[model samples]
Target: MSAVYDTRRQSIALSIVVPIFNEEEALPALAERLRPILDGCGEPYEVLAVDDGSTDRTPRLLEDLRTAWDQLRIVTLRRNSGHQAALTAGLHRSRGAYVISIDADLQDPPEVIPDMLTLARADGLDIVYGIRVDRSTDTGFKRRTAAVYYWLMRRLAGSFVPAQAGDFRLLSRPVVETLKTLPDQQQIYRLLIPSLGFPSGRITYQRAERVAGTTKYPVHKMVLLAFDSITSFSAAPLRLATAMGAFSLVVCLAFLVWALTVYATGRTLPGWTSLIITVLFFGAVQLFCLGMLGEYVARIYTAVQARPTYGVARDTDEEQQ
Candidate 1:
């Protein structure tokens, strides 16, 4: 049966939104693998391929594909907003009962879509996360860092947050609507979705290597994403600053006792070395805390200013279909 909103209004079963950067070479293979699975879902669907100001031939490639595949809708941003902004654009533009966001590299299988749709329909879930069951394909650095990032995120973002779930996931219309209403200047949907406390389910899959082209997310981008994830969702960094201050107090007490003992014993020694070491250590800790606090303040400043996260220059045929 087709996914329907109600008997009256026309609504698509799924809207798969793929964020693209300079991925011209990967576009064709991604489409070839993803389209058939979507068609076989036995429901009306739309693929929102959002172009994040690609400098390569990606824009032209998407345009050419649109003529052949009517369901392939394209949304071109005015400038290269980062991956998350592109996702926000696609999310806002999508009109479907359930929305799924994935990368254009085809690392996450399109085949999982059918099963996700089924589970959502059957169990009445608000969200279904595509959990990575295996990541043997990833490098040792990636695997180790991913583990640490998720571990830290779970502690800070609460226990409901999934460990291995990336951007690949399905969200019901209600969840989508909620996300649109949130005033998140930097969007991280993994944390954003869990914060809602929706009735969510999980579907496991093996993470594969890229189908073609280079990965859009480099080391720098990954680090940025991790930073956003931490600062956006939780105020743990601010709290950590408080902890650091407490530790600094304890150290000061210990130093004071030592100074008193040295004075009482009439064994006064030159304290330039001790003083210098103490100053450097405390200064470093204080600066690190300040930096962490600054990150949060920067986000707050951006939010209060109320800036638009992204702007769309054009869309494929008005995105109505």
Candidate 2:
């Protein structure tokens, strides 16, 4: 941290943080759209591009872009941490009166920066989320899964968590500073931002497709993110597991009563199918409860380890050349 950032460097009025991972194909196009928008914003701004150990041409492309774009800065991680960790690193490193986190794929447009800033100032808001009103570019499966994800998050985390909001949002200095102080190793901005309980505004946009390259957030990563979001924010899963266990007990007791009544009537039902079905049903319920409990335990295990979310291998700001 000491080597990368000069303590004497002046802070800007606004900072836009983009986490990059194997986004080589998208860098040039992202710059093309991003630079003008930042320049037009009327306030001093810097773009902190966090390179999460991209193995492609992304690092070189960033270096080349920085040579031309003075406001662009690079923070390279030692390894490829997940999307949230990269974002956490950028947010922690960024120094600005207001910080906005956007994606490198350009799906979350840069054109909304001015609007976010304006709304934040005009309405005296601490946070402004760039919500997507339309996502017709997404595939049907994606749309369905996303809807379910947001629904589950809201149900489990309470109504405070805003739906249809990604990491594309603006946070005031105080909010950003406060987030930095939180001890959680997993940083899910969607839940984290709304939980701040700040006066907030929203600017809706139609979500666009990637300008270039493949999507970094594949299905597996999405599952992990969903799991992290649930485990980090709410205890509803644990409660649900408990409820299921109780219901299973009730069902088992009812079955026992029925079996005893039939035997007492001297008409014993030879019910191997019923026994098999009952065994399977109870087994499934027990396994489901165990899996839910395991999710929480895994989170607790990670927390007790107290490992840093990410580490920097090198930073462009430190380079003298």
Candidate 3:
């Protein structure tokens, strides 16, 4: 009994997974803030920093920190595989009873982690998300757009996705295991986490602006994320295409009936304009439907190829071991 107890205790108390890109400036500050919190918890914890092919000194900085902090573990991907894939890599590699994922930008605030941990423990919840109560630092346009996006996602996805929720969240071991079972290569963790039917809650915090390094999620990445999120979770776009096709067929039938009535009454009028308009309209609709169909087909093709989601360029910890 004592041997089994000791083995369980050494497995892992907690693991914090931070996916880093060119975040050289923020890495030290993040470590400084997080180290104390983990120490305060009176439990053994390790920080897994997954560097996703950073072009800057981010990899070197992580190595220096690892030397100073024995609890630090680093994983370097072969190339830039985007944020979600990086997070997935870390989660799979982590060995912890509880795992928490956060951005390295420092905007998510490491201080809120304890609160999330507390909530997870008190409620016996499998997942606890850090929800942003306010985003005053964000531009007005961004704030409004985010609100609309969340609203639309909830309506279309038919899932209770908490508003203002980002990747900063805590998950129990069960939740982490369930996440690994999901094999979708697109990797939308935010939407996929809530669908596991686990008891969950939220910790509200005010979001702060980034302290260093440029925003990794620029306009282009934001657009891609929006597209992936919408396409992965909902069939609303495909359904809309179907509805449009039916509506167009009805309109064509109405036009045919009108033409027959005109001929029966012996009213000969130049119908070239109406005929041209109909042709263009239907042509546009067909192209639009085909485009939508192509998007789904492309996704399917990518999945069937079964490519490795990411490759590891270098791993310092693995070498040390």
Measured by TM-score, the strongest candidate is: 1
| Candidate 3 lDDT, 78-167, residue by residue in tens | 999999999998998788899999999888988888888888899999999889899999889788878887888788876588878989
lDDT of 2 by residue, 1-321 (tens): 232234324758888899999999999999999899888876667789999989999999998998887778899999999889999989988888999999988888988889999999999999999898899999999999999999999999889887789999999999989988888597888998898899999999999998889998899989988988888889888888889889999999999999999999988977999999999999999899889888888878988998998998876656744
lDDT of 1 at 1: 16
Pairs clashing within candidate 1: none
Cα error, residue 263 of model 2, in Å, equals 2.0
Model 2, residue 3: distance off in Å is 19
* Candidate with the larger TM-score of 1 and 3: 1
lDDT of 1 by residue, 1-321 (tens): 122423312567789999999998999999899988987877878889999999999999998988878678889999998888999998887888999999998789988999998999999999999999899998999999999999999999888889999999999999989889988476888888888989999999999999888877789988988888888888888898899989998998999999999999999999999999999989988998999988978887998999888888888646443
- Give lDDT per model, in order: 0.88, 0.88, 0.86
What's the count of clashing pairs in each model shown? Answer: 0, 0, 1
TM-score of 2: 0.93
How far in Å is the alpha carbon of 255 misplaced in model 1?
A: 1.3
In candidate 3 the C-alpha lDDT for residue 301 amounts to: 91
In model 1, where do residues sit more than 4 Å from their true spots?
A: 1-10, 319-321
Q: Kindly give the stretch of ten consecutive residues in candidate 1 with the minimal lDDT sum.
A: 1-10
